[model samples]
Target: MSFKGEHHPGVQTPTAESAGFRFNHTMLRVKDPETSLAFYTRVFGMVVLRRLDFEEMQFSLYFLARLGEGDAVPDETGERTVWTFSQTGLLELTHNWSTEDQPDFAYHDGNAEPQGFGHICFSVPDLEAAEAWFDENGVEFVKRSDQGKMKDVAFVKDVDGYWIEVVQADRMA
Candidate 1:
């Protein structure tokens, strides 16, 4: 079952009609907006690109991104919304009302029994420094970089117990 060559025989190349298609973002449901926001911003240095509140739906969609240098973020609401959707690798956190108040409430992290969604990954410039920073911030590690059989790779759990895989690209090379 080695997919060394073409994985899908039917589609040798991308469809011409889908040339403009781009991966927008990955959405994850959070129990508490405040806690989740803090974890993403502090740990990953992501900025809130846009936040849409659906009062009728009783949920809020927060779009966050790790903006690079000279990345322009429109201040206007409509423009910001457009910019947020145009970017790739964005993280969207959906917070439902009253879920934060429920002390026993928790989202299945997709790593347990009957697992579906696995985890999101973050490639860091410096693995050692990032691991130290995670330690300083009291991040819970599922597997340290040097702990398991896999070297130069780590997995840490967020406040919501979501596994975030950390890796250094250069190390893999």
Candidate 2:
């Protein structure tokens, strides 16, 4: 996506930094998996991929991705649902259930306010389209700034109050 920082057009894209290592998956801790699942599914348009349920502990596990036909569903289990999809990239959603054998623990500490996790980011084919969406949704954003020339940083918060950073940097290249 086209990213314009407070200063100028952001550097290159993130993929350029890593040799081949792309972003993998991001996990969040939810008070209720069902409620959280709903947020990702209904709001963000993600589908469940894999999930485990522990009826004994009253907990469930869920995995979700952006919806796309190219994606494949995993083997089914009685415990929970399996969902997968793709946008420009991938979005994975997980729901974990706790049983007598396992107790619940927070996966991440949302301490940085929105800046902590920042936010789970996805790629967009059109930066202007993305900006328009943000504008229509009343999403707030920080303009980008340049430390030198090849590095830029800015912040935006997600619905959950976690910071999502918009970054653009060109390795010494």
Among these predictions, the greatest lDDT belongs to 1
Model 2 lDDT-worst window of ten:
79-88
Tens digits of per-residue lDDT for model 2 on 40-75?
Answer: 665446776666566776556555676568755556
Lowest lDDT sum, 10 consecutive residues, model 1, at: 2-11
- Residue 161 error for model 1, in Å? 0.6
* Best model per TM-score: 1
lDDT of all predictions: 0.94, 0.50
Residue 104 of model 2: what lDDT?
A: 51
Off by over 4 Å in 1: 1-11
